[model samples]
Target: MTTGSVNPRRADTRRNHERILIAAAESLAGSGEVSFNAIAKHAGVGVGTVYRHFPTPEALILAVYRREVRHLVEVVPALLAEHPPEQAFRVWTTDHLAHYMMTKRGLATALRSASATGGDLPANAYEAMVGAVATLLKANVEAGTVRAELEPETVLRGLGGLLYLDSADEWRKQAAALADLLWRGMCTHRD
Candidate 1:
């Protein structure tokens, strides 16, 4: 679509918008900051287009966070295909943790602002992440690989807590340890 087009087709416009969001997320996640000009360059769109799509940095960052969650949701089926249920669960958890770290770096300030204003972050992102985890956990449980007592949401929250620990180095180590603990807790012993 040309820059001056009055109204692009919905699908095409959506594609462009998605591209811009993806580019913005990648740039922000990598650099821990985003510039509109840099995002436009990464998106292969004009700075005006970026402005048209996201009026403020907070809006762009929020969109990027949601996009990251959407991308993570899409990976669930692929991860299931590539790994066993248990392994897939671990892999996806790692991905979720990485996304959390990226989100914390790129959008934490904006998120805090939204909280202060009593604005909710997109709910679908949490639903998608939790749903993916639940699916994987259910699969493992059905396969007799994990304990039925394990709740997917609980495990996810635990992972978040582990990652948010006070010490960065300790947080990483503790996250891994916490994951292992969850795995062991969920595994059924073969007597």
Candidate 2:
């Protein structure tokens, strides 16, 4: 009875944590704000639960940021497994990285508003993104889809234009165009 009870509690806690993060992410993405009351209401949990999960707005924002970065890196393998390397790169750029850049702008603003008292975000974001890019590039190179000597950093830089995407406009189409251009630049033989 004790074991079963503890399991349910833990599962509930995990669900609550995810819900809180999702609500917080939506708030940050929309208004660049973090109000515990609003997040709790949006998450359908008590305000105390929001505080229990993240004691401060900074903690919540940082958690959202980390989650975004982790997803950007973690999705690479599944993408490669599901599609050819070239298609995987396009899907990641247009789907994952582009979305991250949009949310990143909001997150950046929220972080700045939170100020130094929140401390700085970890410095591993760029390195982790670069590693993800490198993995994609390696797969493409092995398949002879991309030039062998191309640098992942270079490819990432080319994709950096995604940071300024106009969310209100046709951003998906724009992202696809940008990815197409980058694809042309990286390809050994154009399709």
Candidate 3:
């Protein structure tokens, strides 16, 4: 019974919210216009539970986008810690490309809805993404593994075309090849 202690019920509620977001993301990945009932069923929760967590589809979409962005931003440091700068950057970028491919459909729809409202959606998603990659790039530059002049935003912008690829199965293969190309272009020396 300490002040500022976590409440079990509140923790459970937060867990449920995250579960709902994950389910919604999965549902939206295939078709951007998935029904709330489908998302609720996917999450193994009642429709009322979903509504309690997200009052509107826009709210759910916004939350999903924010969560996805947060995951990308948060994983960078851990990736760098576990791998060489170049390897970490490649792995992170590859993961990002895959994530974009998986979520592109729903994310596009969500972004349009959120933007139409001019709501609390974080508009700095690119900035956050580039910043994370920049950290890895900086480390590689310092290590002489990558070019010192490479700009994180420029690299990200260059990879933007991958998002428009027509096939999901091909996305993974093409993304890997693109990552290899990027790695070669950025490296100080060819192995």
Each candidate structure's TM-score, on Cα atoms with residue i matched to residue i, is 0.73, 0.91, 0.90
**Per-residue lDDT of 1-191 in model 3, one digit per residue for the tens?**
67997899999888889889888888777677657899888888899999999898888888888888888889989998999887887787777655655686667867787779865778798899888878888989988998889989888876676676545466667777878887888889987
TM-score for candidate 2: 0.91
In candidate 1, stretches whose alpha carbon ends up further than 4 angstroms from where it belongs are 1-12, 114-120, 161-178
Best by lDDT: 2
Which is better, 1 or 2, measured by lDDT?
Answer: 2
For all predictions, the C-alpha RMSD in Å is: 5.3, 2.1, 2.0
lDDT of residue 145 for candidate 3: 93
Q: What's the CA error at residue 45 for candidate 2, in Å? A: 1.7
Sequence-dependent TM-score of model 1: 0.73
**Ranked by TM-score, top first:** 2, 3, 1
**Total backbone collisions, model 2:** 0
| Per-residue lDDT over 87-113 for candidate 2, one digit per residue giving the tens place of the 0 to 100 score | 999999999998888878889877775
